[model samples]
Target: MAKRRLGGGLICGLLLAGSVLAAPPTAVIIGTPPQPDWTQLTPAQKSALAPLSKDWDSMESVRKKKWLGIAERYPKMKADEQNRMQERMREWARLTPEQRAKVRDSYKDFNQLPAEQKQTVKEKWKAYLSLPAAERQRLREAGKSVQLLTPPQPEPQVDESLAPAIVGESPASPGAVPQ
Candidate 1:
């Protein structure tokens, strides 16, 4: 009986240990970070994100988080890359909501293109960018002119009096002629 009791207790202990080992780990709860006041920004972050200052407080949390992430990375970027980012931010700030939406849609569509097609587009853009400023401006002006020239309209409605002469047929009736 003593040996049996010891075996039972050992089995119970084994079962309890197994159950404890199988239990899930405790969840680690991470609290959302509070939004930073404009004054709280580092000088470098403030300079990098100057274009967005006016609307920063009203920005959604996700957007704020993204901007903050970018700001944190800015100091580490090469000079040219940082300048390009600043230029892009300025341009983005200037865009209207509709224009921004169009850009986002265009970016999504571009990203969905096959790799070969994307490469071709990237090559074409690189070629365009390589052109001189004056040449680019001239190309833009030429495109504007092409767009401004409207396509020819369909033939105008024929006057009933003139229809007889053109069609070689008399008007069906006096009522047929428009006022």
Candidate 2:
């Protein structure tokens, strides 16, 4: 009985030790690095990210890092390129969540397209965006109108004479005796 008790105790100790070793590590609480103050941001960084200023502090740390990276690169970009980035950022901010999802899905689909088709889509989209706002709206309306006005295919016709012949009877002509 004593030997059995020792064996059971040994088994229990081994199981406890195994569980201790297999347990996941506890999360360590460590001091996070301080976020940069808005004033501490470089003038160029502030300017390039102006639209985000109001919500900057509320942004996640990871997002702040990403914006900081962009800000760092912004000064090196050409004027036109910087303008394009700013415009894109503004547009992104203005999008609803559903709209953003659509953009993301479309981007993923575009990335999966063949290179030539992707280029064609890119060119067409650029051309579409380059038009004045009113012209773009008018073009969209025209496209809808065209879709609505499209003529449908005519119904298939069966010649009455051939129809009777197919059924093993002659179609009687006007003022003629039926055979």
Candidate 3:
């Protein structure tokens, strides 16, 4: 009878442990975070909050909270810094989920590029934008002929697998000649 009682106690102890393990976390691991009250933020967070109102009800709780925190803290930040942060928040709201994921994945690569490369890309884009509509159309039409005139790229016999890692970068550097 003592052995049976001990076995029953052990089973109850195990059941209790399982329940404890299954209990909800005191600290949330994921999902949306909490948003502070909108009234709590200072002037900058208030400004940031202004553009957010339209979408606030639909935003993830964490993001909503993050914006509220921004409002709370932004009063101490410089005007320029606050404005830039606000712009980023605004842009974040504008992107679709797929676009946001793509940007999230490639953002590190974009951030890693040097200033000169960034400038080069900007200059090329500006030039492309500045060209007249007719000229742009002409260039697109010419591209087909240009491709036809180009010689076939012969595969090199060199075993790149056996070759040393080339220290050089790709030809597509943002600021490099947009060839």
Candidate 4:
């Protein structure tokens, strides 16, 4: 019995020593790059991502990496492409987190469509854009009414710049409502 107790104590002591000598748990995630704070970005990265400066530090590591990749490519893009990217970034930065999540979900859904279905969707979008502004507004209002049975939520404040980019009609234009 004494020998058994000594053996048990020795095993316990080894385990305790092993645990004590082990490295402390790290806050760092494996397989993902370190998310750099905004101040850590280089001048060119800052310039390329100026629109997102306010939200950069709050962004997820994956998102930061994606944007950093875009910034790296920004200098090589054509002038027109660069301008469009900047405009889109500004619009994206203006979106609330829920809106951004919705956009991401929609994008994923769209990408999962078969090639033919994707083409059909693109065509349908074009057709919708071709409709008269008043008709579009009427359609939008009708769609809203269809959702009346659902619980009401506060409306997201629409940015005027986002209006034209989404519906091909400037907010200043007659019958142009930001959806």
Candidate 5:
């Protein structure tokens, strides 16, 4: 009778242990606000972030929150500021992930420069914007070519064993005479 009770208790414990081991982990996110779906956004947010509507659901929560904050502040901005912001949003929406990452890195680098250096960069950008359309196009083309000139990658190794046998070739011997 005592052996029976011990065996039953051991079986119950094994079952409980197996269940605990098989269960998926439950994540508990604290403090961070939930990212809303596109349909969950307010009308003003939808209007302000129209360019990102197609991609809204797929964006990271932090990026969604950042854009939401921008949308919230959109109404208070001046007309020129609103227009600039809209244009930038559209441009941002069009950028590839790699391009966006590069732009973010560049922005971070720019922000870290000293005030005077930042001012110099702004002045240089303004000067570049002031140039003739044709001159700017030429400069852009030159920059693109420079960017395209990356170091060549090494050729991939071929597995001769797995390769298709060439006509008139034998597996046992090289340059074997055909029978």
Candidate 6:
């Protein structure tokens, strides 16, 4: 069979959907650096990209482009987290083409949700997760929107300005002399 194709948008959407289903972390954690290129990857790493490898020859362009984005934002993750990610990658490789297609479709549906409805669903889910199943079902019957919790952003800090010249050293100062 001819190799299957996956669009960049679909791939990104799938990753986003996967992130949404991920369990909330009690503490924030850094993620691992992705293998920058196939050549940089180990045999096990190649295994992680398996079923997709038949298409890999044609897919390298997409892989390189996506991996570069990952590399730039990548942080050094704790070892245990790295191991878990590797396992996930292995399982991701095992997904059948049809399963992948279904995931992509689900992602498309999620993306189509209205912003307000999405927020309501998100709140509802959080509230539901905290309640008994009967209470959650009641809330579910009420029906609300849902959206994924956004990944955390780093806090901003003020930019440090260069030290200004001392009063006597600079031409801009009132008392400084010109040559």
| Cα error of candidate 5 at position 151, Å | 24
The pairs that clash in candidate 3 are: 33-62, 35-65, 45-71, 120-175
Off by over 4 Å in 2: 1-40, 130-133, 139-179
Per-model TM against the reference: 0.55, 0.52, 0.40, 0.59, 0.61, 0.34
Q: What are the candidates' C-alpha RMSDs?
A: 14.9, 10.6, 12.5, 17.7, 12.4, 26.5
Q: Kindly list the per-residue Cα lDDT of model 2 for residues 54-105, writing each as its tens digit.
A: 7678666767788888999989999999999999888877877688688878
Worst 10 residues of 5 by lDDT: 145-154
lDDT by residue (tens digit), candidate 4, 1-179: 99999999999999999999999998965756778999999999999999999999999898999999999999999999999999999999999999999889878977877777677667667777787999778877889422322223447888876866666676577567655
**What TM-score does structure 2 among the candidates reach?**
0.52
What digit string (tens of lDDT, one per residue) describes model 3 on residues 89-158?
Answer: 7887788879878877666755666776656556665776687888777876878433432234446776
- The whole-model C-alpha lDDT of candidate 1 against the native structure comes to 0.77
Which of the predicted structures, 2 or 3, would earn the higher lDDT when compared with the native? 2
Tens-digit lDDT track of model 1 for 78-144: 9999999989888888888798788888789778777776776677667766879897778777784
By TM-score: ranked, best first: 5, 4, 1, 2, 3, 6
- Please tell me which predicted candidate would have the highest lDDT against the true structure: 4
List candidate 1 stretches off by more than 4 Å.
1-34, 37-40, 141-179
Off by over 4 Å in 3: 1-44, 108-179
Q: List the global CA lDDT of all models.
A: 0.77, 0.76, 0.67, 0.84, 0.83, 0.56
Candidate 3: residue 55 lDDT (0-100): 69
Give residue 1's error in model 1 in angstroms: 37
- What is the C-alpha lDDT profile of model 6 across 1-179, one tens digit per residue? 22234576678889999999999978966555343445655565454454445444444454545534533333465667656655665665677768767877867865777777567657755765887878666655666312233322346654333223432345356556744
Clashing pairs in 6: 117-145, 120-145, 121-145, 121-146, 122-146
* lDDT pick, better of 4 and 5: 4
**Candidate 6: deviation at residue 167, Å?**
85
